[model samples]
Target: MALWTMSFLLTGCVIKQHQSLSFCETASPIYISRDDVLTQETKRQILAHDVVGERVCGWGRSNHTS
Candidate 1:
């Protein structure tokens, strides 16, 4: 019983750490195109909704190559 409890606690801690690490690793800057026809107000709302608690690193047009 004691071993099972210890294992459960360790598993929970590992899962929590993994989630945080993954969030940081995947939190890259998002690019928004000027040609998308999005108003400033609309853009702010979209970013706020998508990013939630995370800070946006940067925003601008994404360069594309043919």
Candidate 2:
């Protein structure tokens, strides 16, 4: 019973957040989390990764192929 309860809570918080893959892909970092206090770090990490990935992708696309 205890294990089931713990699993349910964990699933609600972490798994539920990612279930919406479309939301994750389309939503900006600002819309990632509604609770500022709880998701500040998560938002920061996501934003940093997105910025770096976009920069790298842009650079790759512009680099000389010949």
Candidate 3:
């Protein structure tokens, strides 16, 4: 009986994982105007955030759409 129940649980069970679960959104913007100057380290961090947002749960973006 226990084996039958376990089989049933395995057949249709799904694990939904969200990227945001792994990464939290930044409270402040990582980037500023294009005219603003950024240090190399800052640029790298921004790029990393952008790449993650593109492929992941769509975090790291402005609160509203442009």
Candidate 1 lands at a TM-score of: 0.29
Query: Model 2 segments beyond 4 Å from truth?
Result: 1-38, 59-66
Best by TM-score: 3
TM-score of each: 0.29, 0.31, 0.40
Q: What shift in Å separates residue 59 of candidate 3 from its native position after superposition?
A: 7.0
Residue ranges of candidate 1 with Cα displaced over 4 Å: 1-22, 39-41, 46-66
For TM-score, candidate 1 versus 2, the one ahead is: 2
Location of the lowest summed lDDT over 10 successive residues in candidate 3: 21-30
Choose 2 or 3, whichever is better by TM-score.
3
Model 2 alpha-carbon miss at residue 27, Å? 17
Q: Local distance difference test, per candidate?
A: 0.57, 0.52, 0.63
The all-Cα superposition gives candidate 2 an RMSD in Å to the true structure of 14.7
Better of 1 and 2 by lDDT: 1
Cα shift from native, residue 12, model 1 (Å): 15
Model 1 C-alpha lDDT versus the unseen true structure: 0.57
